[model samples]
Target: MVKYLDTPGGFVTKAAASLTLDAGCEFGGGVDCGSQYFLGFMAYHRAWFLQDRLALTVGGGAITNPGRYLVLLPPINGTTAASGTPYFTANPGDRYRAWDFQVAADVIPRPFITFRVEFNHRAANVPYFSGPGGVTPPGGNQGAPGSLVDGWSPDLVKTENRLTGALMVKL
Candidate 1:
């Protein structure tokens, strides 16, 4: 279940929880028998000043998954959710945990337009995020779509920090 609420004072809150039950499969198909659960929560507060021309937002969230069933697999060598890669696999009982904090400042020149800059810091218990080398292999993909090459591997890290800027327009 998931819930979101908009409270007074320009605050927004979100919470989510989920349960997944998988029965063991026959003929080596499907997920193993186990129960997986996830919980997450986040709160954001936005305050505007200078007669609503400038706004700032700050928020952070954390999540935990014991089985890593809902975690997103990095696209190494053009891997997809359906076509999983051999380099890494999230089996049953594997844990995946992550949290992120972000802050954004926006310049609202007009009601329909916004110029924003954001900075985020995210971390995980394991090497899950892409690193400086990125998740791609050398010389692009080879052999099978997501199959391992001769001696190349994806670059994954445990933490990530990024700054981004964007222009948003509403019509």
Candidate 2:
């Protein structure tokens, strides 16, 4: 479960928790990318490959973005005078991205092994943090600030498509 909020327009933002665990093939540990909004359903990707070095290979997969999570916050309040509390606040009911498609490719090293490559494209969701203004929180009216408020927004959520490659050997 990932929970974060972007600032209004581009004022202040906060990303509290983004937890994920794959639990790989042998219960070792699958692939985990922390967490982030997908914009539309055409964001985020996950795949598998079995290759070596020579044999050419190709495959296809799909994508499903969780959606954008945005929020806005004021500065300093989690403390008293100079320092007291050291935690941030993230508004709820943030935006969520949609799901998209994914592509795959690979290079075979040996008959028994091969290499892999993948490319992913995520749609763009609304810019959560821009600079707080007429935009209101999802839950209707903007929530009230805590005793202390101190933070920054416009925190860019990076989902730049990536070029993946790999090398494998056969026994």
- Which stretches in model 1 have alpha-carbon errors above 4 Å? 1-35
Off by over 4 Å in 2: 1-91, 127-159, 169-171
**Candidate 1 lDDT by residue in tens digits, 23-138:** 32212244443445565666666666665677777888888776666777788888888888776676766777788998999988998999999999999999888899887778
Q: lDDT by residue for model 2 over 1-171, one digit each (tens)?
A: 343443433322222332232221111133223343222111222222331222222322223233112322323222233332223233122334322334655555456666667665443244322233322233332224323223322233324455777666767
User: Candidate 1 has which clashing residue pairs, if any?
Assistant: none
RMSD of 2: 18.7
**In lDDT terms, how accurate is model 2?**
0.34
TM-score of each: 0.78, 0.32
* Each model's lDDT: 0.73, 0.34
Listing every candidate in turn, what is its Cα RMSD in Å to the true structure after a full C-alpha superposition? 6.0, 18.7
